[model samples]
Target chain A: MSRPAPRVVEFFSGPDDLSDQQREILRKMGERFPELTVDELPLDSDKARERGIPLAPGLVIDGVILGVGSVVSAGRIRRYLQPQQE
Target chain B: MTEAPKRIYLDHAATTPALPEVVDAMLPFLREEFANPSSIHAAGRAARQAVNLARSQVAGALGCPPEQIVFTSGGTESNVLALLGAAFAREESGGKGHIVTSAIEHPAVLGACRFLESRGHRVTHVRPNAQVCIEADAIIEAFAADTFLVSLMLVNNEVGTIQPVAEVARAARERGILTHCDGVQAVGKMPVNVESLGVDLLSFTGHKFGGPKGTGALFVREGTELRPIAAGGKQERGLRGGTENVAGIAGFGKACELAARDLEGNIDKVTRLRHRLIKLLDTASPGRLNGDPEQTVPHVANVCLVYVDALLLMLNLSQRGICISVGSACASGKLEPSYVLRAAGMSDFASFTSVRFSIGPSNTEDEVDEVVEQAAEMSALLRKVRTPEEIGQCDENCPCLWEERVA
Candidate 1:
């Protein structure tokens, strides 16, 4: 049996100013757990508000708020996903 | 197990650790000497003498006569009494009067202006220039025939930019307008002579200069009459009436004497720390200083770390055993961007990203190095989530400037 990939969502407060960075973060993450899924959304969307996002540049991994108001580094995210890959 | 990081205090502008000498001076008043200064008994007389001696010590520091000093609770109360007491007395004599003040003043002054407005008196709040220094000429220009008072800070608390106090006082004096200087930040740090500054009233507090908290005073120039703000027995010359904080006042007096002693070579020491922080912050954030670099005091360095939220940075630094603040620690529990930066005409991004790193006389070069190294690390990690080079430039209409977004 195969395990499900942890859903990753990155939310930015205003405009999607960090789209390029998210792409870079995703590409780096893909190198490790290629099956991991990532979603980029504007915090203005109802989806982010439904999750009770506290600050901009928020990260939600598998419905758990990993961090807000800062970027949880890509290397750390890779390490976070490695166990799920196993 | 790892060792806990050594704590480094970089928020002296907020409050300093009370000096041991000051604490020792206050111990006697706090304990055995429980008599009120106003009482006529023997212990009371001793208390009165202590209060009088503190007043003289404070007066000697400010270069004013002892009778001119009216001790109050702290800086905020001193400022409130100065603004309201003077304005009300003037208004009672001649119909309601108007006031001219800067927009970037501490909440104490701004809140008092609101109170003055509620009582039907008008006030014009002038904004600072790009450098965050309130212009004396601009304040003078805003003065109307009905403007009877101009309340300006000697040193802006957030940015530590010394205002054009003497020049503005001279100009206001020419027009017979009373000038009130909020000298809270300048009194113990620098040479503060009320006569030389040419201001009719000035405010100072002890905690800001390493004394006990809840101790402050106002310098009311002779012949400058102010109606009493607090109604009580004729303590503080009937201006601010309440049983005095005997211990705190004694500590404040000691703090003043110590400040005067330290003033000889203190600026050079504090300035060295400030310059070191500013110079090294360049490699950390590559952002500019928030206020006028040349016109600022030696004790503060309000640096902007672009795209980094100041609140988040402050939290990270706190966890690392490094204490810093965004703007006024008075507004703690509220995580809004630096309004002083906004008032100084910076972008919301700049305002939100700037952290005030205020050094004190006791801070060392090693501490500055550690702070900059920590700041560089945190800011680098915080900025990783942003794509500033591509899509970070924002305008007023930019959605990124939105104060409210996620529910």
Candidate 2:
């Protein structure tokens, strides 16, 4: 069976806001889930406000904010997406 | 199976690796001689003696009395103490005193001024001239009848442009206004004599000069009084009140001794390297070199590259084992353009494209050449990939005007 379409997006003002560890985690996620779509949102963009995402780093899975303002590990992301994955 | 790449550190402005001599000086205090300097026991006496010796060493470098050196956590605390302390003392004398400072001051000094303003103190922020120098005349013009203090940095943290602190101090002295100099970037990189600068107060940090972090000092001239901002113990002669970082202070003293000994040699070597790097950048690509190259210190080179993102450039440099920083490290990770570069007359777009490469004694000529080559390669690649709309021309008066004309 084919995998479901990728539905994870991260909204960040800039790469500087992401710590080294967080960037590494995202790299691993890209390797593990090639379908992941990373989106760049300007801090003052209307889409970010419409989505209710913060100006800082905010991770969304399936259009829901899974983590905000902190580095969320890949392991935790996998767990959060378990239902969808299964 | 590949070996790790050898890193070339060009970010001495951020922080430096502790010198071996500094580590050796601090080890004893951290291990065998660990004791509270404030205590009355033998071990305490030994610690106190070490602290006293360090004080004298710093005083020797700064050309001030040992008693005038008040140790604080680092540059931030020292600057806060100087601004708030002087302002409070002025208010106590029955006047709502004002402060005059440059827009290019490090956030430590600028933030303190902001705090003071929040508490009702008036402040005037002077702008730098086209050369990125905070002209003494501009500072003097900003002075008000109630202006009690003028805080200016000796060396701008981003551009390394050395201010005319001595001239400004002379101008302020005639008006009976106190002067404070943030010498965090200048003290070790250049020859700094507090007496020669003629400022009423001066701040210096340890890590900037090869000493351990968490160690710094403020030189309060004799008869210059400041109300204690961190009041508790009678430490630092009741001006700064906390048990000092004995090990850090010891390392600071050793660092100062080393800096003073190597001052001339370091300046000569770094100046040559800075010129070579600037030349390389100019020849390799088209970019605006920020700040007055002649007026700035020999250690720093800020460049603004059109069509290149500063963040991407920094990351590419980091991946290539080259380490540098964007603007002040304290203000790094913020999306806002550097206030320092902005105040120096760069538009927001130009400020966002700028990167700072601060050289140190540890950097070699070969490394300088390597960085230049890599920067050129990266700039070309980024420019090719960026869309036309993303690339914009700089203001007409950019420092690279001559280079543009030549190109």
Candidate 3:
């Protein structure tokens, strides 16, 4: 059986201005969850507005807000998505 | 599956990406204008003219006469030449051989002073007050009968604290001590008038202001005599020796010109963004700013988180796509906490938690907002793993002894 694809929504107002390490981690995250669907949210996107996104370049996973800031690795996103599991 | 986009760069103080305009201006000199400025040939004259034009441009940006400028390899060389040359010259003239500098100076100035100490010169380092501002009167009080030079930076790199160069210069002048202002971090970020600063020598770097690296200039007031540290050629009016870096100098000139024209607008925009970042960080993260907020240059902000480790924070932030600095970029590779923080009376823990976010002209409000959001997330994540108790127990004597064991 195959794992269900993770629905990933990334809100970035700017392009790749992040560090090299950060870009690498994001790439690794994509590799880890091959079926993950990434969506770019505009600064004024309705989803971002309804979810009360405080800033741009924020992340949301499975309808839960991942908080504002730069996301470095897939693990960091996973941690936010599944905070209950250590 | 799609990949997440890369992180953003917010650490302009550490260094800057070379501006495309500067690169374009430098290309011709690098390829075609590669001739010795000293040679009397046509190519040499071209190089000479380029060097002279750059000197005038730098001088103009600083509001000084062109003849007062002397180009050097970079800020380090300019600083060393200023401190060592001035002190040694005074010594040779049978005047006071003592020098006074700030406790929070960059290593370039501090290290030179240390070297002078070994050579039998007296040196005094004046500490800053609670606000991280060096008191001119305190420096004045520290002066000795033999004090010949006083070196202070216009802006503190780590904390972004602006010193009173004019007041300090006036104080130093009253006592006949020649003053040298390290304007490397000040010149392009603010309006710098050497005549108003009243300093005998001022050092500035090109890379800090969107120019090519390895190109810097020192402003020497007329009639202030100093012997050359490097002796060989008659380059730089016999003060510095070596064939001129024509391309680098030309780029430096263009960078200065651009900086002068855009100084105010750039400051206003970056300052607003910096304030927004500070406010966001203050609200989201458990930290406080490290220096006097109003007394600093607009582009730099130093935030100190109470319980978080700065290196860990930097690592975490880097993981998130935000590029910033832990402290002075030049001093970051060293495992030690910042000497500047220690001098400012920050505790070892506070010093360890301090990170410098130096903005530049190219940064925008949106980017600053993103940085704030990401930084808050990272801070929250780090705080969870390291409890306050665990953080308190962290010290040089901790049994974990990871750093020592590795060493």
Task: Name the 10 consecutive residues with the lowest summed lDDT in model 2 chain B.
Answer: B327-336
Q: In model 1, which runs have C-alpha deviations exceeding 4 angstroms?
A: A1-86, B1-4, B328-335, B389-407
> Over the stretch B1-407, how does candidate 2's per-residue lDDT look in tens digits?
85646899988887888999999999999999999999999999999999999999999889888999999888989999999999889888856778999999988999999999988899999999866899989999999988889999999988889899999999999999999999999988998998888999999899987999999999999998699997888998889888889999999999998999999998999899988998999889777788887788888898877666565576567656788777623233345677887787776667766888989998899999999998888777555544325434556654335434435
Taking all chains together, the TM-score of candidate 2 against the true structure is 0.82
The CAPRI classification for model 1 reads as: incorrect
**Candidate 2, A1-86: lDDT as tens digits:** 88768766755554554644556777788777887776756645776564544435555555544433346567666655555567
Clashes of 3: 12
Instruction: Write candidate 3's Cα lDDT for B1-407 as tens digits.
Output: 74644768888786777778889888988788778878899999988898888888898899999999999999999999998888778778875478889999989999999999988888899988756789888888988888888999999988899998899899888888899999999989998999889999999899997999999999999999788889887878888988888899999998998899889999899888888999888787767777787899998988877566566566556656678887623232134667787776655566666798999988878888888887787677666544555445335432122223213
- Kindly report which residue stretches of model 2 are placed more than 4 angstroms away from their true locations once superposed: A1-86, B328-334, B395-407
DockQ scores for all predicted structures: 0.08, 0.04, 0.03
Ranked by lDDT, the better of candidates 2 and 3 is: 2
Pairs in steric clash, model 2: none
Q: Which candidate leads the pack in DockQ?
A: 1
State the lDDT of candidate 1 residue by residue for B1-407, as single tens digits.
86767999999888998999999999998788878998899999988888999999999999999999999998999899988998879877987888999999988999999999999899999999878999888999998998888999999999899999999999999998999999888877778999899999999899988998999999999999698888777888889888988989999999999999888688889988888888887765566677787887789888767666566577667757889988623232123556777777666666667788888889999999999998888777656544454213446632233223111
How far residue B160's Cα lies from its native spot in candidate 2, in Å, is: 0.9
lDDT of 1 at A68: 52
